[model samples]
Target: MRILARRISVRRTLLKTGSEQVLGIPKSGRSRAITISPQTASLLRKHQLRQKELRLSLGDAYRDRGFVFAKESGDPIQINNFGQRSFANLIESAGVKKIRFHDLRHTCATLLLAKGVNPKIVQERLGHSDISMTLNRYSHVTPTMQDQAARLLGDALQF
Candidate 1:
């Protein structure tokens, strides 16, 4: 299935349901492709190349899994393992507050919404069932955005 996110089109959905956990899919069961920024795309390409090199170096020992992100042995990494190990370590080293990896998704949605990206677009990118879900979940607006909204409303009401 082709996944299209606004103007950007990605080849396939990198993630799928697993035995331990199920990734949420839209109500329609259709995969939605997300278009990422050019910089992000470049980073992904570099990561894919590194993964390929690791796979070749490991030769037969590599698991040869399809998951985009995998352990050095090419084995799929469990969310709990990543969260408690890599993610937690990174947060601790960076001196950031402890937060679940899932919070990153919320942060992304909040930042995008506060930046004025259309709610519908954010919803599509997030693979939410509908725009209302996106609106309800990430309705937080920054103080700067709130001021901008007020100014825009005042201008509109000006005679």
Candidate 2:
């Protein structure tokens, strides 16, 4: 499954079930594809190689259910576990504002919108059910967008 330039399809989500995590459909019951740069694709290829090496070295000891990111044993890291065990320590070490794991999604959307990617494209990338949801949820991040739009309008209207 060496998918190219990384048109990564997000199909399954890890859900906490009892003491274990199980793979299931996303909350919206939809699968979405996200395109990545060639550089990102190259890095992911390298990551896959490293993971393969680890899996081979561990032999049967590796859990190996095939997660893009995983623990040494190959078991998927539950979201809560990742936030509590890694994200918090990582933030403290990096000296950044403490942010919830879910906040990363917001940040990504905000950055893309700020960069002036079309709202429709952002909506698909975010798997938003509709354009209004994306626009409404991200309205705060678009004041700068409004300024740019006005400037462009002014430029176009110049005699």
Candidate 3:
């Protein structure tokens, strides 16, 4: 069940009871598919294969839940515990500062915006209600980007 694609749907969040339920984004109440890098897609494929192997090893004890990330017995990992237990260790091993799991979302948005990605695309990927929200949140203007914008503006006005 490996999917090779740039987009993954956000239809549901798995619960500890092995349930599939849709969860809307707070404030906006919108859910949308997120575009991912090919490298990320490949990583997800490998993770899925590993999960399948774990499930088969568990036999009758395994739950056939549809979570992209699940426990060995197919139970959903608790979000907070996942950060404190799993992510914290990974960050420490990588020698990165300790940051909350939720900060990843902000980092993703900031990186995308910094790379000159369109605000609308970022908004859709982040499930933001509007482009204005995306702009307000991730409008981190670097000196290089500002200089580039100025050059483009000068070129346009020269004509």
The local distance difference test score of each candidate is 0.74, 0.82, 0.75
Q: How many angstroms is residue 98 displaced in model 2 relative to the true structure, after the best TM-score fit?
A: 2.0
- Candidate 2 has its poorest 10 consecutive residues by lDDT at 1-10
| Model 1: residue 107 alpha-carbon error in angstroms | 1.4
**Which ten-residue region of model 1 has the weakest summed lDDT?**
1-10
CA deviation > 4 Å runs, candidate 2: 142-159
Against the true structure, candidate 1 has what lDDT? 0.74
- Tens digit of lDDT per residue, candidate 2, span 82-149? 89879999988999999988777777778888887887988888888878987777535567778888
Error of 2 at 23 (Å): 1.5
Between candidates 1 and 3, name the one with more favorable TM-score. Answer: 1
Between candidates 2 and 3, the lDDT winner:
2
Model 3 clashing residue pairs (backbone)? none
Model 3 alpha-carbon miss at residue 33, Å: 2.1
Clashes of 2: 0
Q: Count the backbone clashes (under 3 Å) in each candidate.
A: 1, 0, 0
